[model samples]
Target: MCTTADESGMTTLPEISLAKLTADETRGEERQRLETACQEYGFFCLVEHSIPKKQIGQAIEASRQFFALPQSIKERYSHAAQNVYPAVARGYGPLHGEILHPEAHTDPKELFGLGIENEGDRRPFAGATRFPDEASAPGFARSLLALQATVLNKVVPQLGTALADMIGMEQGWFQRHFSPPTLMQRVIRYPARGGKCGKHTDGGFFTLVLQEELPTRSLQVWFRGRWMPVPSLPDSLVVNLGDMFQALSDERFKSTPHQVAHSGLSDRISLPFFIYPDIYTRLTSRQGRHSFGVAEMMLRNMESVAAGNGAGRAREL
Candidate 1:
């Protein structure tokens, strides 16, 4: 029963075990808890999931090794520079590469993004991703891609099934639309600068953040009309619904606003796997009156956020 708090206090995000929901014995109760959390908080911590701890550690190390390379070496994969495939949103983004809020300062983070690498794909944001030479960091691309496959194949579908069941849709209804999903895995490094990613909601269905334990809290969520810190939990993935999920649920769920700020003690590294439905798949509300393609909604939301037009408010999907 984790519900919204008044303006004076922070709302606690419930931590649920994904393993329990996948088991028939506990599925009923676990599903109920998930439904409640989605309706109330729109965010939670996932534990007991299928991803191996060793793989998680390896992914973190691979990201660290990649980032530690000299600027000249890392620049070879720069998204802004090497993106011959203009539709592809893959490759590297330098520090302060993006300004999340036009009025606010640039985000104090560097990003390396890799998405479903389908050759000859024409859809927007779909195509092969650029990778650095093995000389820069051996096996970095292979290891990270392996980790991404595990999440896309094993983790995201189960969560989608749970959501469909909660909404009274047939099991696997939502999962079917995500076949050959447009997925992106981003490794982000935040420096100790005072700049923070301004308040904004994600554009897709949901995001799974694999973050290393930090000395102090760096993630914050907008709840109860105030910003509340989300403490770093070990061996857990922070899960949050995005704008498309909010729309697909017909506003029954929320797409909570969140941001990252400087922790001051140490640089932070986070891996976020963004799960998007197929670009052409049209998501319809339960009532059937509203329907929109995932790509269309995502583009509109991104444009709105970039323009600082109602950036803090959830847009209609």
Candidate 2:
């Protein structure tokens, strides 16, 4: 679906306007286009989604301010320090904290992760996220939570419904699976002179990325045994299917391999929402008996990575 090229000879990701797709007049055609993009490329750029640009800018600024805090203050919320029930994976991870690609090297990026905040939930990767003191980062938590709500309540559900439609399932079929889903928001900062965040596929169902504008293109996808740059586009979000989606779809869709090739010229910031189905919902493939819940698989993979076993290499997640 992404066949167009820009003046710089870089292939542009196929774009889908959410505004047009949501309208009654163009829903069907746009749905078909979305299906094609998923089956062919596993990635696409989303535009005109109705999310306010000003809010996104504010969220970015908040993230920058939080990351700019003193290392000791940030470490107070680190995953190693927080001891909440069910042990949710929400907190800051210093640069080279976890080895994403143990064979090559650890990732040269700092991460701040937060999940849907449910104080009463006792499920793994669920419940309240540790945030900085209000005095230190005023309104930071509120802004991020608002953005998370928008993505989970609006953007993700719309895409899930479309995907169900594409597979000839009833409308809301996939949406049902995501009831009380495990949605995680991650803010990554790759500093200048940092090494690449080595090639790996995401471990969730899908990921929606808001990449900050940078002087040089850094995101690249492996296609046809070679890596190709994914050009940055203003006022757009990049969406890509993950290994779970590919597995559940019986590989009808791809979980493309991608990586960040940090230019080492300027810092880069990216906000990604990793959406997953409910922790108890099972994933099954018509091709075999490979059925498992989203949270189960994700936790297994994360633990594997934390143990230095390199989970992404096992199943490309």
Candidate 3:
């Protein structure tokens, strides 16, 4: 379980080392505690994951190179008007493209997106990926491909297994549904600003974020009505649940609310890998007598939420 500063300070999320948990020396009690945290918080920091440290370093370096490109060059990878993977996105979002939280301060940040679309599968349901051309971002394709492969092969499967067990399902049950999973990789640059992005929850199944050190704060997760500040944790990834988990788990595991508050002083940068089920896939199982479609529910809530009379947000992922 996570521990907070008891002397009137805010709570900080617990940091777990994957190496220790996976070791034979780990105690059953520790595992149980870790599992409970996943059920309640749905967000945690991972250290000593198997991915090569250089891979993260390369990803960061490559993003800097991509973001430095001239506006005209970056426009080549801009989202197609009809592409819904990332709606309303420009080639690279400029500072303040959208405000996530109007109640708090606004953020001055721009972003670039890479869509992940799998080929060889004709199921209109599978997602797609968009890669920048070689000329525009030399070696970017190679770097990103290597990173994506690691995420698909390592991080995702581990989390999938843990999640299945967390929900009383046999191990690998979740993995089976995602043989060829869908993913989205976004590179965001929060310019030096007085205010930044607002508080909002992600719309996917889960997210794994890796960010570089910055002069200002980058991300914050809302837990039990209080905001927990997430500072830069070098050589680690920040993972959080999305709305899909809330529905699938029968509310056993919460998809916690989180947001990125404005950085009072300097610019910051972050890269988040958003993982979720295919948009076209039906979220409700056929075994049930009658059920609500996940997509339908999400659409309804988004419409209702936007209308200012939000259909109350669901409890779990």
Candidate 4:
């Protein structure tokens, strides 16, 4: 039995593992915390989440190794050409000047990217991954790839189901539309500067961030009209839904807006895995629960967002 506040500002997340409940009895109770927190805070820390601490460390180490490479070496895989997978995935993207937050003063940061879908001649959305030669990161690539495979195959599906249930949809409602899909990862290295990441909301369903390490300045989430600091949990990862989740859940879930401030002391490193639905599939509510087709509704929403210039570039590999 946990209690939370509403939009009037008096809410708290239930001290419970909302993800572990499988019975209707517990689900009824869990819904109170989820609905209230989502409506009011738009973000909640997930404790007891099973993401491995060791894997997180490996991912961080891998990012460090890659970013530490000379600019020329890192640029070998840049996102220059388009294959179903490009050899240089945007090739070690630029400083955080234009992209991360388009119209804001962002401290320069370097980023590496990869998309699960449309990579080389492999299967389209099938389990195909293209990493730089192991020689690039030596002993690091295998561990990092293992972690990625685990996260994409195991954690993401569970998170999606939890999200579906949290927003009043039947469990597994979203899992079907996301296979062989476009899952992207961005490994960001935040340099020490007083500048901050501009304000923005994620463009898709949910983002799971494993903070490999953080500078003194932590990432913050915008909830209920205020920026609240989210300090890293010892062994926990951060999870947040995005605009697409908000849309598909019919406003039942809040796709919280968030940003990171520039750190002046130590450099920051964060690995964000962006999980999205297949481009061709639609995301609809449960049968007998909603009126519109999920995909059509989402497409309509996308059109509106694009018309208003709200949608950012699609995360295609």
Candidate 5:
């Protein structure tokens, strides 16, 4: 802990093998590595997670084409028209629409987001899933849907079970709460004007991200009072713990602050899957001193967050 970090910052974040983490013979050692990663840094790269790399690329491309559409066509699907839950989470958030930083400023980016779809309940967080029509961008909706289906089937359950075990919870705990889970997926595109997105902790339990194929050290995390760069690798995705998990685990895990600090070069694209407990799920800290519902925390955050004018996601609760 005393050594000064060199230029190759955060180069040693453990890359866990998901296959081994699930196998009976190797689960023990691999679980320890995962536990440490969550508790110490709250972020790491996930490999052998069974997600299709090619599909992720296609989704990114689809997002690129979608964003590249004429401004008029893009605005046609704005969150305002859809009447998003907080008035700015789903459908479309144009450039500089979100405020992820506490200082109340807009991010230099544009995004399209969708929440849980097809559940029996069509409530905001539970079921109100929406996507652009096929006419918006050819195969855009299908590509993202296919990608989400893969993550939901492959990574979410496995990772959730691993975390439940790490915190000493009984079997099926995650499954119980995550039955028809509350999820939000986003495709964001930032232009060549290099700048930093707001620094804030995620509001969900965790996130799985597929970064652009090229090695752009844009994603950074705050650790030990310094920002360290997350390495980008081929055929693997990035994972980070989030606020709900931190509270649910009684802080055994951390919800570290992170940001997208990109250098103006080429357009940057990212696919992030935000996982949460059922919106109605209430969580209590490990020691039982803190308690709150997932919806409550989210609404609290939305009250003063970033829709350009600062009131939807500017800061975390």
Candidate 6:
């Protein structure tokens, strides 16, 4: 367990290490603990995940390098200006370009998103990735892709298996539904102070976030009417369940509402990998009624985000 107290008081989130989460000796106990965390808080930090240190550094450096580019050059990748639609944008979005919380005036953030390079998959999020040419951001594509691959191939399946078990699914359940997962790799940079993305639940199965180590706590989770600040842990990434998880788990797991507050005096970068089932797949709730398609829910929420209004449940990918 990881618990910390700042000016906002004390907060605790389970710390589940992938090393133990998969080991034969500890898997059952750790998996049970993870399920309890999901039910109680829907958020936790992952530690001891064995992705290469070099790969992690490369991705972070590439993010900084790309974000450091001049505004004019960066704007060249703008989704709107580049003719890519908002529903499944795989390009850049300027500060205030995204509205995660409609009532929060403006979303004081800029972001770039990419994923799903399967050009032949004609689903909503399976479109080919559109990256900046090497001339624009040297090694940016290679580094990010390398790290993303590690997380997808190494980390996701392990976590997904645990999740499948949490919901009583048989073996290969995730594989059957997510053959071409609707994965979205989103990089968001929040400028220092005065911006609150508001409390909103993600509109997907879950999100695994690689947050920059910082002094101030920018991420917070809502529970029992209190805002619980998530602490920065060394060599750890954050994970949070989403509305889809809640629905599929018979709402046993809470899709805790969360937000990114000002990151003190410095800019903060959050690299979030949003995981969804295949776009064309329709999922039935645990109760055997009320079904929803991945594409339908996501596209509707994206529409809400673009219209400058509150994001629907599971509103972001």
lDDT of each: 0.76, 0.77, 0.62, 0.60, 0.78, 0.79
What is the TM-score of each predicted model, taking all chains together? 0.90, 0.92, 0.79, 0.76, 0.91, 0.93
lDDT of 5 by residue, 137-211 (tens): 988988998998999998899988898778766788899988767888888887775745778888788889898
On residues 23-42, what C-alpha lDDT tens digit does candidate 6 reach at each position? 99999999988888887888
Per-residue lDDT value at 216 in model 5: 64
For residues 1-317, write the lDDT of model 4, one tens digit per residue.
Answer: 12233446544433335355434667666656656656766666555556678877877887778888887776665555324332323236656423334445434677776655333435332333445778777645576666778788767776677667776666556666776445667777877665355566776788887774452536767655666666665666677777777777766666777778755476677878777777556556543333344335335444533233333232210
Candidate 3's TM-score? 0.79
* Pairs with backbone N, CA or C atoms under 3 Å apart (clashes), candidate 5: 99-306, 305-312, 305-313, 305-314, 306-313, 306-314
Worst 10 residues of 5 by lDDT: 308-317
Best by TM-score: 6
Taking every candidate in turn, the Cα RMSD to the unseen true structure, in Å, is 3.1, 2.5, 4.3, 5.7, 3.2, 2.4
lDDT of 3 by residue, 1-317 (tens): 23344234867676666666556676345456557667757788877778887987787778778878887766666555324432432235555455454454334677776545455433322334455777778776677678878887877776666655665665656666666555657777766544355666665677888777653455766766667777776677888877666566666666777766555465455778877665455655322322455446445544543443322242221
**Candidate 6 weakest ten by summed lDDT:** 80-89
Q: Model 3 lDDT vs. the true structure?
A: 0.62
Ranking by lDDT: 6, 5, 2, 1, 3, 4
TM for candidate 1 is: 0.90
lDDT of 5 at 194: 71
Q: Write the per-residue lDDT of candidate 1 for residues 71-94, one digit (tens) a residue.
A: 998887887654434422678887
Better candidate by lDDT, 2 or 4: 2
Worst lDDT run of 10 residues, candidate 1, spans 308-317
Question: Clashing pairs in model 6?
Answer: 202-314, 203-314, 203-315
lDDT score of residue 108 within candidate 6: 84
lDDT of 1 at 5: 41
